[model samples]
Target: MTGRATPRSGALFERAQSVTPGGVNSPVRAFSAVGGTPRFIRSARGAWLTDVDGHEYVDLICSWGPMLLGHAHPEVLEAINEAVARGTSYGTPTEPEVLLAEEIVARTPVEKVRFVSSGTEATMSAIRLARGFTGRDVVIKFAGCYHGHVDALLASAGSGLATLAVPGTPGVPASAAGETIVLPYNDRAAVTAAFAEHGDRIACLITEATPGNMGVVPPEPGFNGFLAQTCRDHGALFISDEVMTGFRATREGGWGLDGAVEGWTPDLMTFGKVMGGGFPAAAFGGRADVMGRLAPEGPVYQAGTLSGNPIATTAGLATLRLATPEVYAALSATADTIIGAVVDALTAAGVPHAVQRAGTMFSVFFRDGAVSDFAGASTQDTAAFAAFFHAMLDAGVYLPPSAFESWFVSAAHDERAVATVLDALPIAAQAAAKASA
Candidate 1:
């Protein structure tokens, strides 16, 4: 392990490529975005991933924000183990779903919630519900916000749109994306123009309340508010896709912190990741008027075969119950400690960098000051970032693989783990400087 020995992950990659596409289920996991072999994690405990190579890193990715309590808290594991004994999928209604729904309804700005298997499913179905409810065809989304691989959302206009580099993924027909009106994020004027041009036909303004997809760009002050007002004015539903930020954003939730503080309540909200507590559970629901449009209650049809599976519900319930104010407090304090140390380390090393934070969710952008939109975020030095990433990975610190991704802090990331990461920053920053040079 001294000279960076080849991990068993390399072998696994070879074996996996034969069966799985690009040796990864998810495109990002393929390490295609960042040049290298993906680390195959063997197991994890609080705040750390022990890879197959036996290298231990303080995990900041946190399983894309679902391991909020850390890799396998005893309670969550106990909940899952106990649940598996009961059976995995029942394909019928279970009381746990009701309990989870009740818990979710009691928490954020939503009346009811419908469980789905993934964030993609949540947003996809949520859009359908909006289109059905409003009886309109068009949906407006921000330029950089990723709502999953849904056909309507897999759209980018320009050369990138046709080649399918970023937003425009291959396989989705252009007509499927015709109804989607993509606008620059945080640009109120652009949004106004879109609204003015096609307000009547726009069914919903669906956006991440705070977008992490475009390199952790927090919404500009009043941007979300503008979206809410515009949707209200246009008779278009407002859908907040809070899959990544739902619980990790603050002591309450993403909407609980950012949106509620601004007094903007979206018509629909989607939750996944942390709600599932490392399981495949997600949901989208909001004002009764809109949520009621979904099947059984109305004409709009949305159903998942594994929706509200007992294990996922139990995991969600357990995770939610454990994420008390105290846990959020711990997460914030830990994040502050880490971000401060990282900034200080980079500054001392003379590396131009800035960190963006939304509650416990944050990202270290390889540039200075604020990144309010995707265009500004694109200015980040990805090469410098790739060097920093590899340095961190080598130093036993696991950040999000891509520069655009957010680094998550969990309740389980105590002082020890934070210190390991803080210590690694100087080395990473130094490497970043050299790489940029």
Candidate 2:
């Protein structure tokens, strides 16, 4: 697939900007970091995205962590089509929603669930539930682990907001911000200190199982277990914000961190991305006792008109069904291939860098040594990354526009797509080297 912009794409972006903010639905799509007009995607299939110019490039960002099976997979499309024939939003209960919920509970092994429209909604609702469940106001979150735009959790979010370099938005009331305490990721001591000071009134400690916002920072040996233990000791609820890491990290929704990571579970879990299958579907669940306290049974008020829309649930169900063990193996293998190739290319080019990986997710950090915390991740050479990003784009490749976001690998990223990335790396590396110099 060649990455050439069609005149139509350029025209679309120009027109879009007049109406939409930054000429894109999301911020990073504007290619602000890379310094170019964003490509207008006409359609996507399998591992490739076709721009309006009739150009195709291997997709590495994977729609920012959904489209695990790739865009418009026949199976997923069929599921979506069938669901649409039955009518769209019901604003009430649907059988597909029940089945999807059942599938999620069975797979993630959560006791109960509440569906929401987006990852933001799922996490925002989870935070409210956490506060209600624990009867506390303070929330503990890591600096780089983004849990959507939920005011309290936005202390230091990743993704587009990170690329824009905003600490936190201005509209959030200082009173709301006061309840949030941002701690450095992968630093056990920071967590300890926060709990020591505000353990009593702390309702929940929300965090990503593996920090993806700051380029995929995995827990440093037993850190997650420590959080679980700390929450238990302090009478706080551990809320795992797996909106990004959910099914993308593993079939069990980053809970693999608990078992493979020291054998413990958080009191609440939020999920989105892969579960949505490229649509707006997300959920939060945990202990039955806690989830039971959500609505008719309890007092925490949270509702959405399209919470469990049939099409979204069907797409989610189809996506989850395809993420079997075999699919996960393919995803891991592809991620390893792309990341390993990038690492080798950078080393050969003598570019200073480090790469982080968690399951099928990875990121290239343009910094020396490891990035263990938000401060450390921030040390990445953004100027250099911006140059390399455009170079890769020119070379018919798509990378996460910012140095702070994780690159997703899907089962659809076959050896051919991985090979295309490997081919593009040398150019990207050279670009990074010059930009750094």
Candidate 3:
């Protein structure tokens, strides 16, 4: 089969660069890593994306994991439509927000919930609440775990300041970064050391329940449980950032995979993506007493003008209600087929790679061994992945543009979608092998 042409997408990209930064709102959408023009999606339905050029491709990104039931799901659309008909935002409390909050509280370990506009807000608020509740200043996070672009959390560890961190980006102040302790993922000893050194001053230790940002690097056995207990021992809050994994990675988010079974729950949890049903909605919540500290209640202040926008909440509530056990089962089955195909194709093509999974979420690393930390994830063959990525794109399969991100599948990824992906993998794997050579 011949490669699909993206002339319209290419033209739009060139035009967009004149006004937008790098021709995209989000950095990854610029396709800097893959060396190609990003596809301008015209519309999406079920598991397929129709680019502006009128080329159709099986969508594997699923809008970075928010389209859990898939794009433009009828029920979700109807709910959103109804909400829009009533009103968009009212600045006053709404029934949808209340109902959504109740649903979230029931599904997860949180006793109280506060709505936010984005995942960044959810995490940012959770961190503030933790600091206020504990009356501490320091925070700890893993190197690979991404907890939004909050100033304090946007930090990188230095050789000299192994436990302490320095600003990872220009805008983040050094003082803000100084309050964070960045450690390697799956490393219990480093976490122990950080706590021992700054136990008294530590406010919280936050992490992705099963990090997907660095290609779905799952926690080692008992790692999350250990972190939870460690925070308890030090009187610090354990905030689980489930912005990507919430509701999508098992019904109770990443907690259902481990914490629910291990008998440990995070002091606070941040959620987005699947919960929002493709809308700009997110939340943070936990023990009622700890959450009681936020605004109009105790001391810490956090508020948003569009905090519980009715449309967003209604969409989220509908998505959550429809994400039944059967939907998760279908998602898992589809993920299993895709993961297996990827491994088989890569192995057959003699391409060195490792596939890591956390429930339904997973990623393929162009390396031989398992990836447990960001350091390990960084060692992937990006040149090879770039080759494979373009090959898949050419073959009408839309994958996440970057190698260091999770490949998502939705319940809507039926047989046809899976078949499209499966057919593309072998060719893409061969491309990767050639690049490696």
Candidate 4:
């Protein structure tokens, strides 16, 4: 297949760069990792995206995992339209917010919930609540587990296992980074050591329910349970950031895979993505006692003017209601078909690769081993992935622009969408092989 023409997209990008940094609001959308012009999508429906150049492609990114039912789902659209007609934002509480929060609490382990405008706000507020509830200062997190760009959480691990972290980015102050302890993912000993050394000062330990930012590196068996127990022993809160995995990974989110089965639950859990139904909505919730510490109830003050916008909440409620067990079953089956085809194609092309999954969410790493930590995830052949990515994009499959991100599938991914991806895989695999050579 010939590469699709993207002249209009290229033109728009040139114009955008004059005003916006990197010509994109988000870093990954810039396609810097893949070395190409990013497609400007004009519209999306079900499982396909129509770019500004009038070229159509099967959408595998699914708006970075928020489109669990696919883009512009009819029921979700209707809900949004109705919400907009009623009014966009009202500073006072709305019924949709209450309904959405109830839906979230029903599916997950959270007993109470507080809305936020984005995943970053959800995580940031949860951390503050943790600090206030425990009267402690230090926070522990794992390397590569992105809990949004929160200042304190944007930290890099120091030289030793339990050493204090340094800022992962330039703007985060040293004092903010000093309050965080960054450790390796899936390394229980490092977590134990960190807690052992700083237990008295530790307020909480936050981690992704499954690390999707580093391409779906799942927690080792019983790893989450271990973290929960360690935090409990040390009197620190355990927070599970499910912004990506919530509702998308499974009906109950990543907690369904382990915490629910293992009879353990996080003290505080953060949610976004699918819960927002592709709108700007997110939340943090947990035991009522811990949540009670927030402002208007207790001392810890956190407020947002547009936190529970009715339009976002209404879309979320509709999406959750439509996401039945059957929808998830179809998503799993579609993911299985695509994963098998990818493995087969890569093997035939003599490409080394590792495909890891967390429930329905998964990613392909351009290497041959199991990836348990960010260090392992980083060892992927990114050049090879970049080649593969462009090959697939050229063949009309819109995957995530970066290699280190999960390829999302929605319930709307029917046989036709799956076939489009299958047809592109072998060629993309050969491209990856050539890059490796």
Best by lDDT: 4
Superposed on all Cα atoms, the candidates' RMSDs to the truth, in angstroms, are: 2.5, 3.7, 1.2, 1.0
**Candidate 3's residue-wise lDDT over 357-412, tens digit each?**
88889999999899999999999999999999999999889999999999999988
Q: Looking at candidate 4, what is the lDDT of residue 210?
A: 96
Give candidate 3 misplaced runs (Cα > 4 Å): 1-3, 160-162
Candidate 2 residue pairs in backbone clash:
none
Query: What shift in Å separates residue 231 of candidate 2 from its native position after superposition?
Result: 0.8
Clashes of each: 0, 0, 0, 0
* Candidate 2 Cα errors over 4 Å, as ranges: 1-6, 156-167
Clashing pairs in 1: none
lDDT of 4 by residue, 1-437 (tens): 23778899999999999999999999999999988899999999999999999988999999999999999999899989988999999899999999999999999999999999999999999999999999999999998899999999999998899999999999999999999999999999999899888899999999999999999999999999999999999999999999999998999999999999999999999999998999999999999999999999999999999999999999999999999999999999999999999999999999999999988899999998999999998999999998999999988899998889999999889889899999999999999999999
Best by the TM-score measure: 4
lDDT of each: 0.85, 0.83, 0.92, 0.94
Predictions ranked by lDDT, top down?
A: 4, 3, 1, 2
lDDT of 2 by residue, 1-437 (tens): 13454689789988998999888887877878667778888888888888888877888899999988888889999999988988988787999889889988887757898899898898889889888888888887877788888877666432421111124778876666777777767777767777777788889888898889889888888888889899999999898888888888888867775644566888899999888888899999999998987888999989988898888999999999988899888888888778788889889888999998888888889999988888898888998898788778777778888888899877777778778888889988888888899
lDDT of 1 by residue, 230-259 (tens): 899989999989998888796457787667
Residue 53 error for model 3, in Å?
Answer: 0.4
Determine which window of 10 residues in candidate 3 has minimal summed lDDT.
157-166
Candidate 3: residue 53 lDDT (0-100): 91
